[model samples]
Target: MKIAIVGTGQVAAALGKGWAARGHMVTFASREPGTERVQQLLADAGPNASAARVADAVGRSSIIVLAVPFTAVRERLEMAGDVGGKVLIDCTNPIAPGLRPMFDATTPGGATSGVEQIAVWAPRARLVKAFNTTGAENMAAPRYNGQPSTMFICGDDEVAKGATAQLAEELGFEVVDAGGLSAARHLENLALLWIHLARVNGMGRDIAFRLLRR
Candidate 1:
């Protein structure tokens, strides 16, 4: 799969490296594609990975991962150009300065969730809420105690969700289908709890959410 990942941050690097290692053609979309930082990222991602301008990367890939900050969602989407008919995986949480959830305040359309706001920003794109409830370290190596950590994903488009699920699985995650995109409300809130536990409460970044069934 040709995956375009926007942003050069930890989450983007983790997902890009994981997918690249899995033999997927990973293109990191960046504002400074020619910078040394992006060059290092490409080197770290291996031969299957490359860097390009946001529009160029998005134009060439079928799957686009928005790994940028919550405040830069609209700007990044706009930079990607026409993303219609593409699977857009949203890996961001609407977090305020104090690590507080601020969906309504952050989103322009009064969206209840960050994914919903992303859908509003790029309405034509097939949006899936995923990779938001865990740290980037978990994304890089999801296994804990020899078991894969759960990755919760939700989207209105089943096909898009399936594609996103496959990517999550490729990263060693146990995917859980969390219903329609509206369910992102709970998922985003779940992200808050994760941040609280991992950062605020000093539970450490190694912790991850899991689901057990008999």
Candidate 2:
């Protein structure tokens, strides 16, 4: 599968490396593809990976991962033209200044989640919310104590969610279908909880959530 990761952040690096390792062609989209950081990420991602302009990367891939900062979302989407009919994986948190949840404040009436806002921006693309609940460290290795950690995913499109779940499973995670796109509200809160635990509680990035059933 051809994948476009639209960020230089840790989530993009981790997932890009994972997919590239699995033999998928991974291209990281950057405004400055010639920079040392982008070049280093390309090198680290191995032979199957490369870097390209944001629009070019999104144009060439079937799966698009929006891994940019919350503030950069609209700008990145504008650069990624005509994403209709493509599977768009959202791995961002709407974190504002002072490390607060920005979605609630910005979204009118609090009726939609961040991922849903992405859907509004890219009306034709199939958007799925995943890879936001945990840090990139756990994303690189979604296993703890010999058990696969849980990754919560939600989307209105069943096929898109299935593909996202498969990708998460490929990265060694037990995927939990958290229902429709509205569930992203809870998922983002879950991510905020993780950030709080890692930053405030000092539980560190090694911690992850898992589901146990009898």
C-alpha-based local distance difference test score of model 1: 0.93
In terms of lDDT, the poorest run of 10 residues in model 1 is: 100-109
TM-score of structure candidate 1:
0.96
Instruction: State the lDDT of candidate 2 residue by residue for 1-214, as single tens digits.
Output: 8999998789999999999999999999988999999899988999999999999999999999989987798999998889999999999898766766777745685545788788888989999999999999998999988899999999999999999999999999999999999899889989989999998899888899997999
Residue pairs in clash, model 2: none
Superposed model 2: Cα runs more than 4 Å off:
97-99, 109-111
After superposition, candidate 1 runs with Cα above 4 Å error: 104-110
RMSD of 2: 1.5
lDDT of 1 by residue, 1-214 (tens): 9999999999999999999999999999999999999999999999999999999999999999999988988998888899999999999998877876677544566788888878888999999999999999999999998999999999999999999999999899999999999899899999999999987899999999999999
Winning model by lDDT: 1
